[model samples]
Target: MLKKGLYGIYKGVEFRITVDMDNNLKIMTDKKEKTDSTFEDTYQSGVYTKIVKPNELVDCVSVTPFGIIKGEKVQILQEKENKYQVATGALLVGSNLNLPRIDRDSWLGWVSKGEVKLFEEITPINPEDL
Candidate 1:
């Protein structure tokens, strides 16, 4: 199924990104817990992610419209029906690169792992186990 949100569907898909040891890393998230307005919870994770597409880069009548997401950049490398490659650009919201971070909020994705394409739900699901 395709996704529903504030971004675009395209000849290619969009991706959020991060770098570790100067290499691209995929974003991964795990909801730690629900709070009762008193305590805090956290999780240790090694996965990374970024969100792309489904956006037009401008808005009005919305405050924090890009809440969690501050900005987006896309480079169209080669876009086919199932494959998308691109050059890169991203920015910190409020121009605060000193403490820049990418937000993960139900962003759909497509990446080639070996000769296969992958999404978070697919790579982690057990079609047989279900």
Candidate 2:
């Protein structure tokens, strides 16, 4: 699990938006409970998989040494969650991890996402790169 105060970004499959995936991801949500007459139980909706760099972004430093950030975005890519959960939830959620700047566009946007293959065994990279 990621520590507190760490900013995270969303990354996952393309999730070709369609009835097939939408119906599937929708199942992940637990909205069975009825809401009060005033509002209604609609808060718990579209929750799905997320790819946090699995770590926290260190406090900003003056300059980056070298080879720290692969690019502007960082993704965990680790299967902290299960595949079935991913697919089905993808049906419901459409994306994962609601970090700062990570919106629906960013989640679907390729540039905002990361590579799962690379995150397989990623390690902490220091800004100084000793």
Q: Please report the candidate that would top lDDT against the real structure.
A: 1
Q: What TM-score would candidate 2 get against the native?
A: 0.15
Q: What residue runs in model 2 are displaced by over 4 Å at the alpha carbon? A: 1-74, 83-104, 108-115, 120-130
**True-structure RMSD for candidate 1:** 19.9
* Clash count, one per candidate: 10, 5
lDDT of 2 by residue, 10-119 (tens): 12212111112333211111222322232222344533332112122243122211111233223333233321111111212333333233444333222222232232
Candidate 2 local distance difference test against the native:
0.25
The residue-by-residue lDDT of candidate 1 on 21-121, one tens digit each, is 54523222222232122222223352223322223221211111111222332222233465433222333321332222234312222223222232222
C-alpha local distance difference test of each model: 0.26, 0.25
TM-score of every model versus the real structure: 0.16, 0.15
The positional error of residue 92 in candidate 1, measured at the CA in angstroms, is 6.1
Query: Could you tell me the lDDT of residue 130 within candidate 1?
Result: 17
